[model samples]
Target: MNMNMNMNRKQGQILSERFEVAFNQVHDALRDIVQINDDRFVVLVKVGAKKYQIIETYKKDLEQYARLRNAIVHEKMEIGFYIAEPNAKVVSHIEKIANVFSRPNYALSIATKNVVYFDYRDSILKVTAAIKEHGYSKFPIYKNKKCVGLLTSSSIVKWMAQNMENSSVNLSDSHVSDIMTYEKEHPIEIVAKDINIFEVENIFEKAHRKKQKIEGVIITEHGRADESPLGMITAWDLIQIDYTVD
Candidate 1:
C-alpha cells in the first residue's frame, strides 16, 4: 500500500515532508560527528563547526535552516501539514547539505595529486629546481621506498644559512639528507586516502592548537609512510579553499 497518496498531498505538504526529512538528516549526521551532543541540532552543529570545516563553512546556513524548520510546523502538526512550505530552492539546498554530511568527502578528492617529492639522497639543487619550476614549497623525502621526512622551503633556507662559508652556499655539494637535519622531527603526518576530509581538517586544526606546524599531510594507500603517496594536502591548499587551518 502506498502510504502517501500523491493526490491528497498539498504542494506545501510535499515540500514540507522533503524539507523536514533533509533537515532531520542533517541533524542526525552532525550528531554522529559531534563530540558532546546536547540533543539540540544547533548545538551539535556549533560544536562540530569548531572542528570540521564542512560544518564550520556552512555553519550559518545550518543554523538558519533550524529556525526555518520550526517555523514551517503547522498548527495541526501530526497531519504532515505546514503553515508555510519551504521555498523549493531552500529545500533543495538543505537536501544537498544533508547529502554532503552523510556522504562525506575524502581527503584524496581535494588533495594535490601526483605530489612532487624527493629521495633523501637526491640533490638539494634538484629540490630547488623543482621548487623554482613548479613553485611548490613542500616535498616528501623517501628512502628504501619508504618516506623518511618532508622537505620544505623553510628547511632548505635553514640548510643554506648554516652551510654558507662566506656569501655563497653550495647547493651542488649538498643532498636532501644534509637538509633533513635542519627539519624538525615529526614534520608531517601520513594518512590513508580513505580518511574523510573532516578528519583531515581536524588533524590540521589539532596540530594548530598544539602550536606545532605540520609541513604537509600525505595521503597514501594504508596511512603508512611506507605506502606511496596518492595525494598531499598543505596549509596553502586549505587556505585556497577557505578551509580553516593554521
Candidate 2:
C-alpha cells in the first residue's frame, strides 16, 4: 500500500511537470494571438483574417483561462477544475466592453483609433498646412510613431514670429518630438450600456468631487469598450451639445 501511495505521488508530480511545459507552449501561442495595443486600452486578436479588439485589461483573465486550458490539455484535469467563471460583476463588465468595440462607428471616432498625426520631422510649413486643412488648432506630435507632445497653433505662431527675423527657420528640422505628451496610462470611466443617461450624469457629478476628475464615462457592453460611443458625457462636450440643440 505504501509503495502504491508513493507511485501516485510520483504520477502527480510528473503530471504537474508535463502540465507546465504544455502551459508555456499554449501561453506563447495565446500571447501571439492577443496583442495589447496600449495606444488605446484595446486588444487586437486575430481570429482568422479578422482582427477583433478586446479591452487590454482582460489579459489578466485571459491568461488565467489559458493556464487552465494548459492544465486540462496535459494533466487530464477535469474541465470544471480550470473553467472558473469570473464574478458576476466582472462577467457583466466584460460583456459591456465587448459590445462597445463591436460597434461599426467605434473605429471612426478620433478618440478610438490612432488617427493621422503629424511629427516634428515634417516641415513646419507642412504641419501648418495640415492644421489649416483639418481645422484643428492643436496637433499631437510624434517621433517614430510615438507621441512626444502636443503643438498648438498659438505655439507655432509664437515660434514663427519670434524666429521670423531668422531666414533659417526650418521648422521641419526642429522636430516636434520635444513638446509631445508621451503615452501615459489613464483610468477611463466606464458605464454600462443598459444604464440610463441620467445615471451617467449622476456618476459624473459624483466623480467631479473626487481628486481625479473623470474625463468621460465610456459606455461599454460585455465589459469591453466595444460598440458605438453610447455618447460620452464630457463636461465640455455636454455643454455644447445641450446648449446648442435647436
Candidate 3:
C-alpha cells in the first residue's frame, strides 16, 4: 500500500464512522460545485449544466458532511445526490426541501412583498430607479391605483438610445404611462397563490412564447383584479433555479 492509498483509506474510515454507515459502491459523482450564495445560507449544488438549491437551515450538521465531500472532490471530484438514491433515506432528504417548497404562502407570497411597480405619471428616472432597485427587467405601470401596462427595460433602453445623439433630450418629458401597454390592450396571465413554482415556471415560458415581448407574470390569490399584484415573476427569476444544491 502506497501513502496516498493509506491516507484515502483512513479518510474513508473516518467518514464511515462519523456517518454510522457501512461503505457501499459509489452512487454518483458531485460535479460543478456550489455553496452558500444567498444571505439565508442555503446550499447550492451544480451538476453538469443543471443546479439545485437546498435550504441549509434544516441541514443540522450536514455542513460538516458537505465540507468533507467538498474536500475529497477538491474541484476534481463529485458527490452523490441524495435524491438519486433508491433507498428510504432519500425520501427524508427530499422531504426537508419539499417542506420549504410546498409552503405556497412562504415561497410565492414572500416574493410578492418585494414586488416593483411604477406609477403612470412617474418620470423615466422614477421608473428606471424602481427597475434598478428591484432588479427587475420589467415593471407593472399603474395609473389611478389601477394597472395600466407593463414597461420593459428593453423598451426604455431603446428610447434612450434613439435620443442619445440629441443633446436636447429631456428624460423628464417621457412618462412611463405613455409607454405602457394598457392592461386592457394586452392579455395578462395571472398565476394564483396556490400554484406551485413549477406551474408558475410554465406560465412564464408560455407567456414569453406567445407575447415574445412579455417576460413578467402577475401573481394573485385567485387571479382577480381586486387582488393587488402580489409580485411579478420573471424569466430571469426562474432561470436562477437552473442551478442545483445537494
> Best candidate, lDDT-wise?
1
Candidate 3 lDDT over residue span 106-186, tens digit each: 236434455677777888888777766776666776678766567777777667666665565667687875565322344
Q: Could you tell me the lDDT of residue 182 within candidate 2? A: 30
Model 1 residue-pair collision total:
0
Best by TM-score: 1
Which sequence of candidate numbers ranks them by TM-score, best first? 1, 3, 2
**What 10-residue stretch in candidate 3 is worst by lDDT?**
22-31
RMSD of each predicted structure: 4.5, 18.6, 11.8
Each candidate structure's TM-score, on Cα atoms with residue i matched to residue i, is 0.87, 0.32, 0.50
CA lDDT of each prediction against the hidden true structure: 0.82, 0.44, 0.50
TM-score of 3: 0.50
User: What is the full ranking by lDDT, best candidate first?
Assistant: 1, 3, 2
**Shift of residue 220 alpha carbon in model 2, Å:** 15
- Please tell me which model should have the higher TM-score, number 1 or number 3: 1
Question: Candidate 2 has what TM-score?
Answer: 0.32
lDDT, residue 200, candidate 2: 46
lDDT of 2 at 96: 43
